[model samples]
Target: MLQDARSVASRSSQEAEIAGPASPEFIDFDRLLAAVRRQWRLVAVLGLIGLLLGIAYVMTAVPRYTASSNLLIDQGSNRIVDELSTSGGSIEDESGILSQVELLKSDQIGNKVIDALHLTSDESFMHSSVSLLRRVKLAVVSVVDISSWFRAPEEEADDEAEKRLTALALLGNDLDVARVGRSYVLSISYTSPDPVMAARVAQAFANAYLADQLDSKYEATRRASSWLQQRIDELRQKSLETDLAVQRFRAEKGLIAADGRLVSDQQLTELNSQLTLAQADVATARAKMDRIQSLLESGDTNSVVNDALASTVINELRTKYLDAAKRQAEISNRLGNDHAQAVRLRAEMENYKQLMFSELGRIAESYRSDLQVAQAREAAVQRSVADATSVSAGANETQVQLRELEREAETYRNLYQTFLQRYQEAVQQQSFPITEARVITDAQVPTAPSKPRKPLVLAISLFIGLAAGSALGAFREFRDRFFRTGDQVREELGLAYLGSVPHVKDKALAIPTQKAGTGTEASDRYLRANNAVARYVLDHPLSSFAETLRSAKIAADLAISHQKKIIGVISVLPSEGKSMISANLAELIASHGSSAILIDGDIRNPGLTRAVARHATAGLLEAVMDERPLKDCILVDPETKLALVPAVVKHRVPHTADLLSSVNMTTLLDEASNAFDYVVLDLPPLGPVVDVRAIAPRIDAFIFVVEWGKTARRVVRSTLAANPQIAEKTLGVILNKVDTEKMKLYRDFGSDEYYTSRYSSYYHQGK
Candidate 1:
């Protein structure tokens, strides 16, 4: 049951080792900071280079000055003539102002300024300056004609048009036009090498714009006047022709007009008046005749009332008849029949009645004659009016034509007069000069150049440099694949990190020791003289470096189950200080009055044998192969009383793997296990040979040594991966040659705890 449990535990340990540690959380900021810190030197160098480049640009760049001129465009001002200026006032939108802006930027204004200032002939405005670098580039381009590979090459010929275009482009580049806020003011700026030229060009632009505006207005007025004059002359001739046509029509049709009345119209008016008078006369005469006839028919002379009644003859006749009737009536009453006087009176009364009848007949006959005459006149006058109306009707057509001609003449005359007045007004306006814009402020020579802002350029340069440096630093940090701290060793290799050994100032004197005797004194003197890093536990046990090794010793003791634990110190590659770890660990154990021995297992190299060379004549090779006693090969340090089996020999043994696994080597280990409390072997690096693999099963445990921030994690992992049998026996990992100051940059696994500022006081130089 116990065996099964042990097998299960072993499997669990292998699984845990293979699984490695959990992946660390991805803290981008921490990682970025660490990467920057790792390559801060490179960043600094690049930043310095950028600063120099900025300085050089500031020193070499050309200076330019800008001068501006302001103009007030009176958009709200009244025009010369309200009627002639048919163009509407400024709109509520920006279109009118924008159009003015475009006008200022147009080639017309630009060319005027250019000509006035003689800028077309000036080299500063027309020609571009070529730098040395540009000249070199041109030379190279002329020498090599590789452009043909991409397209058909053509000749670069210069012409008059090209020259004008180049000059125009240069002029445009130097000129700038902008509207000043929401006002009617426009700002015109010009840049040049000379401050005087800049100011002169700006002022010239404003003057040219004003002159052009005035000329435009004058030309418009002149054209309008010319057109109006032509139209007025034509209207005058039309008016004359219409008047002459009216007079000619009147003469041809024999129609005359007076006071707006025609000759035919007068004739019609006279005929109508005569006809009315004749009808009135006829009616009066007919009324008188009818009254007279009525009186005669009735035979009632006394009842008749007329103007004829007032006539003397008619009145006398009527009076006589009435007297005779009265006398006859009186006689008839007095005398009976056959009276002579009565008969005679009746005869006289009859005679009187007859006379009265005759007189009324006479008056009636006279009225009837007058009526006949008046009727005759009325008939004649009616015939005459009819005839006159016929003649007037004929003349009416000609009169209508004459009236139409008169109307046309009148209309032409009115139009002619209006055009003539308008033409005079246009002529007067043509002499008046006006402009839409005026200069508000004239440009002056500037005192300082506007370009080459030193501080801004330097600041930009510094920012660009820092960005580039940071990018490069990040790239370098990503490219490096080495372990930097104990956390990296534990996380990547899946091995327990025992401790870190801080890099001491002195190599050999890091361990403090008191002189024991001559022999020990001589060895110390040799170690101190040769400058080797060895035997720290026997010298200064209180030192951090010595304490770290002591911790490794304790780790090994706790890990190994064997009573006499055989611990082997091994590394993935060379130069990892495995031999140093072995020496220190053994010395640390022996310092506690424990029987400990260090073996030189690396026959090929024998680093420990060389470190203590005086007593390393006969080593483990002789003990294992030459049938010599193990005690004969044992070398003891007199001060620490540490036993060592060195590998110093005349020639290195071949097939070192076979030799380490031989029976003699095993018997020697077993015997040493019985005599010593701990056995430390300084084995060859696991990468270069199979010696460590051959000797791994014989040892109780293995101590893996890694160079801090130097050994790649893949190398250490691959070394153990290839030899799984030895990996299972690994006690823990030791990170040596740690830069305590640099280790503060890493925060994972609490790596800074052992190397922080508070721990610096615990580290001291061994006395």
Candidate 2:
């Protein structure tokens, strides 16, 4: 009971929020668990699909082989030659030790291997020999033939040799390289079906590199020798030309040859003597010219005459000195003899006069001597000077020529020496046993080829397959709209359910039966024998949906008799237990042994007959039209003591809606209530038909039966408003088809999650 109350309260609270087809809107883990439980079969099927894909992947995939070479790339190898030095060249190293492995992988080395192994093919080998389509074919074909072909052959081999060559080339491609650690040893591995081919390919790599190193050394030697010979010839020519120039100069000058067959020591010594003499002459000339110019600049006013002028040159010189002394004396007389500047100037003037007189004496003597010497001797001296000048000019020209020859010769000599040394070194290196970088490890041929993981592909396909299947199942679950849960009936309609009639999967449901007559009340009796058999559903006052149902029913029964004689049946949609309402009410009332007659007034789709079985006829139609008398038209159920009027018609006319709502229907309603204890009318939904409006005022009160979540209160309210006075006689709502299990849940909780917030408040307050 507590559990049912909690469920009702929870549904009521949830209905306040989203207003859904109310069970408890709160989907607890249990309900979710239930939904998942239902889908477990689907999950299992999908899982099986996933497993199949995984298996398929494992079965159909191509086996992939990876051949890796382990190499110890010595990090310290770079430092190996930092301490080594050549005469003038730097250490020829590219990270010395580690780069050895890289060189093995170099195109130069690899190309050598390719050439030695003859791996390059003309056209077909360039593109992938096996691809996705080809692989699929191979996979399919491989199923039948074990040794068909590793890869499809492009052109059929013409001969055995060609076939073997092609096979070898195909197997050669499975080669790879890598550094293992900081070790110096490298392990090279190649992948191929033939183990011999793998080892051969690795050995081919080492041989190719060794051959390249030897070729490099030989080429280097050849180049060096060629360059050196050319340089030696050029230098020899220059040396000869320099020697020839010296010889030619000596020959042209008629100079004595040196003891060494070029120029003599005596000739050189003589040239040096002449050079000194010439230099002395130039110095003397320069000195005289400078003195003459200095004299001119000093403005020496005193001059001395020569002996030929019949003058005492010395006396003239002395007179000038005397004049200078007189001038000095006059200045001294005026300014005093002790005056420093005047004294100094007088002394300087006297010294200048003495120097002039001395120089005059020397010049007079020189002039006499010049006159005495011959004019022929002067001419001869000029000739000697001219000859010396010509020789000096010739010598300077030779010096410039010598300089040019020397510079050219020096340049060639240096280059010749360099090339000679380089050539010598190359010859030396070639003579010795030079060790070149060699591959230590051969490539290991891989046994398996890598690609086309079939198991993984199949696994993915299976996953997709299962997803497709489960989605289909879920879609069916969503499309079914029968009142799936008892809570849905109660909450959506603002009504509560009395009970659920569990699905009795009886085969009898399929048996077609003639529509029962008014005497068919026996079925109802079997259905409801005890209150326990009735599945009494009590509403909780704490539940909002129950409150809504409570409000709607109280409003519907505002003007009712003690027994609530007037009953207004409504449903959220058509055929939602409204007919059930009429039947059950009659059954309940009749059980009290109070006279009750059920009216089948739903002119359209009259299903009251289906529920009561006694009224599935045109008796109600006959009575309204005055075709049948009340006593004859009325039906009395044998088992339930409930009377049913049947409108069992031969042909159902369209105007039955109008006839049931006519004044005659009202008169019939008043008269039937007087005759029987209670008259229950099974009207069509207020939405579908309007027969109730005409008959409602005569009713004392009404009872609305709503399947738990199947009916909406707003619909009931609107239908009630159509006959406002009768609507007031509503005796409250009865929730039909309530699930006992679900009812217990909300009843214990007493609200949905939204309203459950107050739980803490109340719980804390209680604490």
Report every candidate's CA lDDT: 0.76, 0.53
Checking candidate 1 for backbone clashes, the offending pairs are 512-539
Score candidate 1 by lDDT. Answer: 0.76
Model 2 CA lDDT for position 747 = 35
TM-score, every prediction: 0.56, 0.40
TM-score of 2: 0.40
Q: How many pairs in model 2 have backbone atoms within 3 A of each other, for residues 3 or more apart or on separate chains, i.e. clashes?
A: 69
lDDT of 2 by residue, 569-660 (tens): 65535756666556655655665567878777776676665443432444677777864667666656554567777555566677765786
Candidate 2 segments exceeding 4 Å error: 1-28, 56-483, 486-493, 509-561, 568-585, 592-594, 608-617, 655-660, 677-767
Question: Quick one: RMSD of model 1?
Answer: 21.9
Query: What lDDT score is found at residue 659 in candidate 2?
Result: 83
Candidate 1: list runs displaced more than 4 Å: 1-49, 67-121, 124-129, 133-191, 198-446, 505-529, 652-654, 747-755, 759-763
Which is the leading candidate under TM-score? 1
RMSD of each: 21.9, 17.0
